[model samples]
Target: MAEPTTRPRDAALGSGPGRVLLTVYLIFAVAAGARALVQIATKFGEAPLAYLLSAVAALVYIAATVGLAVGGARGRVIALTGCSIEMVGVLVVGTLTVTDAAAFPDDTVWSRYGSGYGYVPLVLPLIGLWWLWHNRPRDRA
Candidate 1:
């Protein structure tokens, strides 16, 4: 039997595809967080649910970024969880906002499948999930 080769803990954070994914995740984290903050501070009463959803999305993005950058068993788990939640969020919010306008008076990060953000919000989580899966660490023999 052949022994499995494993990547170093710092490998994902160093460079290459992992680094690129991390960069993207960081961008989403920043953008989502900033937008959420502005919405909450300026006029939370206008659309509390949407603003809160944005904050949750931002936190998920941040977690995913950290997981990708960390590159380990724990990181994989965190990234997977975050990505899954993000996917669900985008879909649910997108559908609700479009089908029921009364509930969502304002836009959220996932509103209309991220139309406001050029759909980057919709695509980012999928890409992050794919990257994490692709860079998954090999099991030790």
Candidate 2:
């Protein structure tokens, strides 16, 4: 008996460059989450705002990873929102960290355009949004 293997209409989201994107997102999620957890658990008082922003970045990366893995209409929407938020956060945080170093007092994943992480944080969302847009569902009329 042949078993039925259903193919997802949006499976493309997790293939090709999308796979690389997902891997990066997963790495960032783990990295940011771990860093934020350790900072918050240990020296939170030293940089509460930075630590909190790191935690938020972790959450956004996690959401984007899950959305890319899910690979469907809803997943696209989730990924879009996650990437959009990430882009804004990185830009705003990066600018603030550069213009007002005293206000930050500590580094986040998005600090200085993600200079701490090789600037991947600054470029990731742009790639993600482009991937999502490129793989968007077409009308099957």
Candidate 3:
């Protein structure tokens, strides 16, 4: 029997693209989490749903960052799940905000498809999912 081929260790961690993605995920996680914290602390009553959504988005970003950093089977699954949730959240929240503005007095990260964040919040998940899929480990036959 032949040993299964595996990716080089350096290729997994030191890849330029992976580093960039990790950095972006980290930044988003921190930003979203901090903003949610401030919102919840100062005025949770103002828009509870929106604030909670922000927190959720922050958490997903954090998970994505961890997944990318970990880079393995478990990590990929985590990242994939996060990305899927993110996509759904953005679409739902964005539509709600636009179609029923009265329901959302305050802005969440996904409000208006992340318009306030230059649509990065909207696009980030797609990018993350794509990256994860691209880098997914292939079984050696």
Candidate 4:
């Protein structure tokens, strides 16, 4: 009989520290998505850009959370993609919100580098990338 396949300890997605990470991501996903839904449903015209950006941020968070919770090669890729875009989004949006406050009269998840959410938005991507890298697939001899 063939031995069962198993991943390394670090490759566990929803285990140990990954469980904490997953929980946090889930929270943000709900918060950002709900906020966006409310903003768009109630007063999108008041701040269309902010509302749309919030929606996009919500999607990214959802993707990241799902990917991490479903750990595998595909999951790693998804998580990495989501995390990468998240980092870029936070950097660009943070700069825009700071340099041109008028452009962003309202807040998105990335606004002020995630200051509205205690900066977890800014740091989450970095940690996600690290997790992905740590669990990266190894070449067999």
* Model 4 ranges with Cα > 4 A deviation: 1-11
Return model 1's CA RMSD, one decimal: 4.4
Using alpha carbons, what is the TM-score of model 3? 0.90
**Residue lDDT tens for model 1, 1-141:** 999986765346677777777898899899999999999999999999999999999999999887776667787888888888989999999999999979988888899999998998789888877776666666789
Ranking by TM-score: 2, 4, 3, 1
Q: Give the Cα lDDT of each candidate.
A: 0.85, 0.92, 0.87, 0.88
Choose 2 or 3, whichever is better by TM-score.
2
Per-model TM values vs. the true structure: 0.86, 0.93, 0.90, 0.92
lDDT of 3: 0.87
Ranking by lDDT: 2, 4, 3, 1
Candidate with top TM-score is: 2
lDDT for each residue of candidate 2 in 39-112, tens digit (9 for 90 to 100)? 99999999999999999999999999998888788888889999999999999999999999999989999999
lDDT tens per residue, model 4, 1-141:
999987655458546888888888899999999999999999998889989999999999999998887787777778888999999999999999999999988998899999999999999999989878877878888
Candidate 2 ranges with C-alpha deviation above 4 Å = 1-9
Q: 1-141 in candidate 3: lDDT tens per residue?
A: 999976534227455877887888899999999999999999999999999999999999999888777767777778888889889999999999999999989999899999999999888888888787777766679
lDDT of 4 at 2: 100
Q: Model 4 misses residue 60 by how many Å?
A: 0.4
lDDT, candidate 2, equals 0.92
Q: Which ten residues in a row have the lowest lDDT in candidate 1?
A: 6-15
Highest lDDT model number: 2
Q: Higher-lDDT candidate among 3 and 4?
A: 4
